[model samples]
Target: MNNRLFLKEVDQRISQADLHKVDNAVFVLHDQLNMQVWPEWVREEKPPLVFIEAKAKGDSLPYHKKKITYVLSSMRHFAVECQQEGYPVYYYSTDQHYDDGLSDILESHPDLVLTFMTPSEWDSRERLREVKSSFGDRVKEIPNQFFFADPDAWKDNIEPGYRMEYFYRDMRKKTGYLMNGDEPEGGEWNYDEDNRESLPKGYDVPEITGVEPDDITNEVIQMVEEYHPNNFGVLDDFRYAVTREQALQLLDEFIEERLADFGPYEDAMATDEPTLFHTNLSIYLNNGLLLPWEICERAIQAYENDKAPINSVEGLVRQILGWREFVRIYYEAMMPEVRDTNFLDFDGALPELFWSGNTKMHCLQQSLKPVIEQGYSHHIQRLMVLSNFSNLTKTDPRELNKWFWLAYVDAYEWVVLPNVLGMSTFADGGILASKPYVSSGNYINKMSNYCTSCEYSVTKKTGEGACPFNYLYWNFVDEQREAFEVSGRNSFMVNMYDKKSDEDKKAIKESTNQFLNQLDRYSG
Candidate 1:
């Protein structure tokens, strides 16, 4: 929070070619098949252009120092692709020049600078608004054709006070994914009962496709190494889907090997298992390299061709059309005000192990290692493990929020912020999630085998071998007694808290604070 240090950090990022790629595909949105006249928005604005490339406040953690370079690198590559096809392109980097990016766009005086709409940090949306408004008729925010939902689709009716189940069901009917006319294929809207099945004890994951980017990414990797030298993951291990070809190849791999079991073990976790049945597709999907529709279409093609099952295909589709789209829409409908809403009102520091990965708890240690080693963890790991722990500890939403934003590779503020503050932390009332995803170590045991060799007992709440999570869970309940007392969803927790002896209650408080006293060091 030191202003001098903060400004100094900002100054550093500004010099690093931050705006290396900023220009967008300047296009006239035309209806090719209809052969009709272009819309007034298109007509009024001569040839419209948007600044497509983005940059973050890389003044934070260096988990993916390569992340910044990847963006600039891929953008520069994308710019080349556009230019080859005779599309005028402009690009910028926040590293080399910061606000100059906006100024450069203004000098062009393009009809409308379009971008896939997103919110950065606290001031980003407002700053973008000022830039757009300052330009008067120039800045037009558009829906990312990258995602499944219509841009304004969820704006008018953001289904509040509901979890994803109902949303998933509605999306099934609307999209006709896994549907035959009006009825769902397999006579099921969701395969929840079937999907939760785990891989047999020593399950082996098939080979995954890794894309070593072309020279552009290689150059960016070199740049990140030269500048932001010290980071969590090894740069040599960096193999993100940087270009369109790599993304498509990865899509084919998962569809061929992992897609069938992906649905069943989507939420499963394990100590030794890194890429169990999960398709490491998020990195590609988050970046513009792979579009969600193409992914879904390919998976759906597999099902129709009898290569993959309806269950597998439908589950993957629901993620894109249902969960992914829902999150983006819900995020747009309820941001700014929503980010600050901490309904439970719990306040405490996060545990030290989050950054250090120094914990005796085996589950955390195993899960957290990948986050450090790769700058990526799937949604289940983010939500149910690291984030769930943060919520239960009642860590300051901002504190936990900052870590999530700083660490992950795919964590652009637009995507990460909503997932972090809204879904993971549940700071925004119940807008993104119905309840705080608080859990004891036992839940971790149920999901993964990380509990098997842990020093602490998942089965015990107190005594010499008592799990720290047991203590934390009880303390979290007691800490938020006033708010949670009325929560019917948390009634069972309250009842359990009431059943605890004073000695055990005192012990839980002591252990929980000991854990909370050291928050900054822990990422999980």
Candidate 2:
């Protein structure tokens, strides 16, 4: 937002004659690393590629170190690859913002017209538009090629309050993925009911074979260590794929080794098992190393070959074709307003346990530890454990959203905003989720191994030594009974809460207040 471009130096290789010789150049963001998503002119012209490593963006939050390392490393590697492929690259290691970097590029190259594909996130697109406004017709923006459906496509088809299932079915019909003529492949739009089984004891969990860091990544890791010495999480075993080929290999590995069981144990969690049959390709997919249609097609192919069940393939497809696209569109539709919406008016600060992982609660410990260590966790751990606990304790949705954005490897504002404020916390007033995803220890006990070795007893419903979730969930429901009753689908939760005896209700309130006050003492 500041005019800090004057502080940074332009690459010496980009001379005025070179700029005049170039008719057009393409601006590449950190996320748009793949050539497949480039403008059509890019391939023919083989024009200069401009990349900016904006340190200001990295400094916006105390981001996980591995996340910073992965993004910068990938961008550096892609720039190197582009140079090797006979393209001139102006790589700027700037301490300024993206707009400053773009302004410098335009000012340095007066004769050179710039072409850029639309960035995935809203803020990035807006920044680019601001730069374009300054440059007039010298800049051109193209459609984004990474996603299966354009965000604009939803303008006529859907709105904020629409359920994802309906939109997912529409996507299925539009893409003809998992569709058998007019009906769904299994005569159902979703296979979620078949995809909730817990992992069996001693199940053979496949080892994740991650991509070892190359010299480029190692350099970026050192750079991160030097610049972000005090950032969240360590970069000890950095194994994220930095290239399109490596990302494809990870996709293949997921389909071959894990896709079959992905449906059965998709929701399951275990101690020290962070991935657990889930495809850890979100890092690549969120960037442009992998495309959505290709990922969905591969899953569908696996199902058609009888290598995976329909439930597994359909579930995977639903994630990309259904949930991912839906959330992105929903974020676009509700943004700048959705970011601050707190329908429940939750005002508690995020617990210190989220950052320190200093908790006796087994589920929180197991879930938060991996995130603190690796900047990664499966969706259930995110939805059921992290967000569920935060919602029950009345943590401010914005604080939880910021923590997620700062912590996760795959997080960006566009995706994290809707999932946290809308689905996870119900901060959007049941627009994105029909009901809040709050739950007691029962769900965690059923879906994960965390409860087995927990300090708190899952068997006990309420009182001392009982699971905090049990009492906290009822307390939330009791406190928000009017809202629950107003939401037609979850009014039964209020009815269930009313059935408890007066003595039990008092115990529940007491235990929740005690736990919350203790949390506030330490964190708030």
Choose the strongest candidate by lDDT: 2
RMSD of each: 6.7, 3.0
Tens digits of per-residue lDDT, candidate 1, 314-405, equal 78887777877777767677766766667777566666777668888787787777777677676677888888777776777877776776
Model 2 stretches with alpha carbons more than 4 Å out: 1-17, 156-161, 520-524
Q: Per-prediction TM-score, please?
A: 0.82, 0.95
Maximum-TM-score candidate: 2
lDDT of each: 0.64, 0.85
lDDT string, candidate 2, 1-524, tens digits: 33323222222223212555787888899988889767666876788888887888899899999999888877877777787777888676677778788888788778878888888777788989999999999999988887777787784544445889888998899889998887999788888899999988989988878788876677677778888898888779888888888999999999999999999898998998989999998989998889888999999999989999999999999899989998888887887778889989989889888888999998998899889988999999999999999988889999999999989999988789999998998898887887888899999999988898999999898888999999999999999876676568789999998999999999998999889888942242
lDDT of 2 at 189: 81
Could you tell me which 10 consecutive residues in candidate 1 have the lowest summed lDDT?
27-36
Q: What C-alpha lDDT, on a 0 to 100 scale, does residue 472 get in candidate 2? A: 94
